[model samples]
Target: FTPLLLENTQAYEAGKTGTEIPNVVHGVGVFSVIGGSGSTLGLIIAVLIFGKVQAERTVIGISIAPGLFEINEPVIFGIPIVMNPVYMLPFIAGPTILAAVSYILMDTGIIERVCLSAPWVTPPILYQFLATGGGIKAAVFTAIEIVGLTILWLPFVMISNKQNVSEE
Candidate 1:
């Protein structure tokens, strides 16, 4: 993920245009809350697959917004998440499951959406605080999402490793 993001289009543009990665990428703003550009990219990819199409669409738009924290478009457009065979399985399956779970939780009042529209680039704690009205549950859920993304991404990692081995 680190290497990919480094070589990703946004990074490339920065290098080409002579802007730093910080500015070229989304998130990283002043007076912002709820930021995690990397994780949000992962989350959105996952959600795009699992969520109602509209949910995915909504996140995408928010990501494109200039001042909004979600700045997911850079990673989405830059890393070019879709084409990698390594990502296809996880990208499609992981978020669907996670997003569905989040949706269920929200629907049943296990969780609620944010009132503050925190930045997507914000750390999980801040995001949780802002999203959950300053409750610890949001942080807990964010941690769960991280763990879930790891678990969700494992199969792809394994497959990629196996493929590399076979190629050798």
Candidate 2:
């Protein structure tokens, strides 16, 4: 997908300069981490502030560091979100909405498109900054996305709290 995205973007006239790379390539890193560490960070904060389930702490503890590095298997498997109805919506919607917003921002030229490639493992704000050739707007936009993703996950985390209480 990364290669295809890069090819597609480069095929376009606007993308030829690398400044106008599309969401597919530019968003690769964003999308990869947004759902993983990004959402996990939100879940951790939400649980700490609002959760009643003491057991969630274990999940948070295990997930926090990896989440920072854009790895979320612990959160996903720990939360058991695979078949959980409560988490499905925000889990999918957060990244989708973010990508859309990113696309819009790039389309309108409000922020520079990703003109550089960085390791997907790079932290979120830093990755955006490098991808945009050190553009501040991209970094700012990534920060906004992190906040927004956190907000998106908050209510769901709270809902899971309820489920946890009920189950215990």
- Pick the TM-score winner: 2
**Whole-model Cα lDDT of every candidate shown, in order:** 0.45, 0.68
lDDT of the structure predicted as candidate 2: 0.68
Q: Evaluated with lDDT, which candidate comes out highest?
A: 2
CA RMSD of all predictions: 17.1, 3.7
Q: Which residue pairs does candidate 2 place in steric collision? A: none
Taking all chains together, the TM-score of candidate 1 against the true structure is: 0.51
> What TM-score would each prediction reach against the true structure?
0.51, 0.80
Can you tell me which runs of candidate 2 are displaced by over 4 Å?
1-25, 28-32, 35-39
- Report the lDDT tens digits of candidate 1 across residue range 1-168: 334334433443444322222221111221122223334444443444443334334545555343135454553554344576665665566555655665455445464433334444555556656634454655676666766675565555455445544544
